[model samples]
Target: MRIIDAHQHFWDLEANYLPWLTDKPVNFRYGDYDAIKKSYLPADYRQDAQEFELAASVFIETEWDPTDPLGEVAWVNSLRKRESLPSVMVAQAWLDRDDAESVLAAHGQTDFVRGIRHKPKAASAPGDVVPGAPGSMGDPAFRRGFSMLAANGLSFDLQTPWWHLPEAADLAEAYPNTQIIINHTGLPADRSDDGLAGWRAALMRAAECPNISIKISGLGQKGKPWESAENRPIIRDTIEIFGADRCMFASNFPVDSLVGTFSTIFNGFRDAVEDFTPGEQQALFHDNAARIYRIDPTREV
Candidate 1:
């Protein structure tokens, strides 16, 4: 089947300054990301995704140097000029920062940029959530910067945990014109029964906002390999909650590669939705991303 990978990344560690990959390792959820610290440009990604019918991919920001947000967009634009695989990008921007407007304007000037990703301040656990905290999604200053997206014709790529989905829902409600694409199924790393129950309820709340959509990627467990049995239920539930039109499939490649091969994740998604009609499957794999990200699948860029 044809595909538009909704969320993936490419980084040149030697040429670019990705502090997370270069500096002393931070407490990464995937644990010890040293394996992927090396450059993963278009060629490397193509090799890993060679078996799949990948029509195009969206390059989400790889936490490039925070001081130079536009620098990352420029580098991705350069890559697109030569490689043409990442048809579009979700560039990095800190919504709560002082330079947010100027940075967002710079990104808007780039033709290939479709959206912005700023992982809002999240509570460590569900109970710790404090609404309207500074830098959190509800922060007045953050929302002030977020309000700028609609005028720029850019969407928001949110990567907060599921516990924060209520805040996400409120943000979506407040900014109905600005599309909010939830990354990684709201980062549902907890798979226990109560955990999933909370996740499902939170997802349902986010889905109620018509402007919100979700990418079903980054389902990797800390120690376990990416398996359909472990993720199929979550995948199916996400699609059910958001519906095929609002949901899309993604590799979350290189990062998810820590858990399994490209085929393992994509194939598992395909298998999980095998019983759905071809149209629904098409939306999940290809259509939703193309429409949501404003990608021209036929253009080959």
Candidate 2:
């Protein structure tokens, strides 16, 4: 089947500063990382996805240096020229920063840019890597940055943990005109039954807002079991909650490479959703992403 990977990334180690991917002493959600620390480019992705018919992919921001956020978009735009697979680009902007509107405007100038992702994971308890104070999304400056998205004709990608979905829902409710996509199937980091229950409940809450959609990717976090059998339940549940129209599958690429290969992650999604109708399968793998990202699905890869 032809598939459009809804979320993935490419990074040049020499050209960009990706401290999180390389910096030692990092407490990544998944424990050890030495496996996939090298540069991951489009060619590498093509090789990893060799077993499947990869129609297109969406290149998401890699959270590069905040000072020159547009640099990441420019660099990825160059890649998009050389490789047609990443037909869409979702750049980053520090929404809390004062100069966010200017940066967003610059990003808007790039034709491939469809949305912006500012990491909003709040630090609620101790030992959280990216903890934010309570109600950080409600801050005046942050909301101000968010308000500018509609004017720029861009969408928003929210990446907070499952617990923060309700807060994200608040923002979605406030700005119905803005399309908010929840990344990583709500990032269900905790695979335990109790943890999964929390994730499910929060996902339902976030889905209540019709404008909010969910990206069912990035399920291969650290320490999680890496197999289709393990992912089947949650994958099915996610599709059930958001329904086929609102849910799309993504590879999450190099980040998920640590858990399994591209074929493995994507094939697992296929297996999980095999019972759905052919149109539903099309929606999960390609149609939904094309519509949401405004990409011409017929574009040559």
- Candidate lDDT (C-alpha), each: 0.92, 0.84
In terms of lDDT, the poorest run of 10 residues in model 2 is 125-134
lDDT of 2 by residue, 1-301 (tens): 8888889988888778877766665557667766667788988999998888888888889878777888888788788778775798889898888789799898788788999998774755324533235336767678888999999989998887888888788899999999999999988878888889888999999889999999988887667656998788989999889999999999888888878888888889999988899999999998898899888756638
lDDT of candidate 1 over 38-122, digit per residue (tens): 8998999998888887888999999999999999988988898889878999999999899999988988888889999999899
Please give the clash total of every predicted structure, in order. Answer: 0, 4
All candidates: CA RMSD (Å): 0.9, 2.4
**Lowest lDDT block of 10, candidate 1:** 25-34
- Model 2 residue runs over 4 Å out of place are 124-135, 298-300
Per-residue lDDT of 236 in model 2: 93
Query: Best by lDDT, which number?
Result: 1
In Å, residue 18's CA in model 2 sits off its true spot by 1.7
